[model samples]
Target: MRIIRAAKVLTGRQGEVIVDGEVLVDGSEIVSVGPRGSAGEAAEVVELPGHTVLPGLVDAHVHLGFDAKVDPVTRRSPESERHLLLRMAENARKLVSAGVTTARDLGARGFLDLALRDAIEEGLAVGPHIVAATRPITLTGGHCWYMGGEADDERAIRRVARENLRAGADCLKVMASGGMMTPGAAPSWVAQYTTEQLRAVVEEAEVRGKGVAAHAHAHAAIRSAVEAGVTTIEHCTFFTPSGHRFDAELADVVATSGTYVCPTVHGVMWRAREVYGPEMLDDWLRGIASMREAGLRLIAGTDSGFGAAGVDNPTDGFVASLEVFAQAGYGNAEIIELATVLAADACGVGEVTGTLAAGKWADLIAVAGDPLERLADLRNLALVLVSGRSVTQAGVDTVTASVG
Candidate 1:
């Protein structure tokens, strides 16, 4: 048994915060959480007098196979499967060290993400609890087609979904529209799959007790995905032929449909400003604000590994997404919820993790200062614990046994 004493603790539920908080852990599960003195003496006690403790973060979208280089596809083409697995293990360690105790990997090649997830669960590697999608289903010559999950018609879509489930995929990821990565593919504003085809995929996944995540960028595709009853929507950018557009009616429908949205906001502000310009960036921010106003459930996710260098680093891209949410007018509590409890719920792990609650996994992080006062304090992580084991301390990584 261990007791973690901190100055403050955010439970990540109902906006609860305990002063001079103490969390009790028995093995990998949390036993209790309350005031410091409430927890009796234990075999081990870790105290932080000036730090705030919170649940470990959950990133709703990520790509473990991506290397975050200039040309990730070309960089990965020549590597053997063994080398690719090695890189993925390294990336997963980086994510865990950065306080991301749980992450949903939306895309990967050759079902490597599944192998990595199992390896971590089997205590062979240290990493976040991964909800892996295996390979994203797409159309012929569509976005991310090189990963080899291409299905055009309803029958093919059902077949692919079944195959992924048989291979032990945690969920299904379907590309409803084109993407920015593949050259000569359909534009982001165009839909790649019909509504019936998408429904087939969703129904098939649901029957197998698996959720479906849809990658949609266009307004039409977003509506189709919402109507198809996908578990979540990724990168709901609402792109048009000219640029980005926001449809309030559609947004209202999405909000009412109980669908979660992952904007996949990256922390690289300078690069975004350079590419989209100030006015355009402001427009994007406004769109996010509008989503919030429409009562849409937004979660924090960095499309890490697609192109932003250093995104896979422990403290860079993930924190940047929170910072972006703050700059867009989210309160400290709301932003924290998006990363912790909300993110976990979106990824379908709410009961197991995401909060400093009894019977849940003792996955949490302690920061030097109060994040409510300044969001940047999150970057000053003092210690990261996943499944009651300390994997990082004061921004440095430490090797620990993998706890499934």
Candidate 2:
């Protein structure tokens, strides 16, 4: 048995906080959590004075295969599968070291992410628990077509979905609209697939007990994805050719349907302002705020890959997203939930890993200060525990240690 004592603990559910908290772990699961001394005596006890402990963070949207570089698609194609696998393993370590215990990889080529997932599960590698999509279903010549998931018709879509399931995909990602990264593809605001086509993909995934994540940015695409009943809407920008547009009716439908939305917000404000101008950035922020006001369930996602500006690291990008929400007037508690409990729920793993509750996986992190007071304190992570195994100590990767 192991007991981790901290000055404060954020339960990551219902905004609960425990002072002088202690969490007891037996094997890979949490035995109990409460004030200090609640666990009585343990075989091993680690004290973290002047620190706050909370559930390990989850990044709901990521592409493990893309190496976060300018033009990552082209850079990724030539690499051999073996090379790509090795690179992904390194990326996984980076994520776990930064206090990200769970991650949902929305897209990857050649099913490489699944191999990494299995490796981590089998203890062959030290990394975050990965929920991989395998290969994203895209349209003919649509965004990310080079990954070889292009499907134009219903039959093709169903076939691809089945193939992914056979390949052990945890979820299905369908590109409902074009993307900024793909040249000559449809505009971000243009729908790549019809509503019926998207529905087919969603139906197939749901029938097989898998969730579907739709890559939607345009207003029309967002509406179609909502109508298709996708589990989560990725990049729900509600964008238009003219500028940012928020469709209230569609947003209401999404809220009513209990669909989670990942806005994919991870960029510096000043840099964005330089490109889109201050007025456009303000409108974008207002749109996000309006969605929250309309009862939309928003989760944090960095779209961390391809060396994007603010998404250099999974944990760092997520923290930056929380800061963005904070700047947009979201309270610290609410902002933290977006990356912790809310993100885990969005990725379909809430019961197993989101909170510091009994019977849950002991996946949590300890930081130097209270995150509620300053969200940036999360960057000062002291230790990371995944599945009750210590993966990092004092901001560095260390050999996994058994508590008992």
- Estimate the TM-score of every prediction: 0.94, 0.93
**1-404 per-residue lDDT for model 1 (tens digits):** 99889999999864699999999999888999999878889998999999999999998898888776645664444677788887788788878877789999999889999999988877677788899998899998899998778898888888888888899998999999998778878988999988888899889888878788899999999999999999899989888887679899999999999899998877775566776577666777788888998899999888887874322323236887789898888999999999999999888889899999999998899999999889889988888878877774432333423312
lDDT of 2 by residue, 82-128 (tens): 98887787778767877789999998889999999999888888788
RMSD of 1: 3.1
* Model 1: residues with Cα > 4 Å off, grouped in runs: 74-76, 308-316, 393-404
| Residue 313 of model 2, lDDT score | 35
Clashing pairs in 1: none
**Candidate 2 accuracy as TM-score:** 0.93
Task: Give the clash total for candidate 2.
Answer: 4
The top-ranked prediction according to lDDT is 1
Off by over 4 Å in 2: 74-77, 274-276, 307-316, 393-404
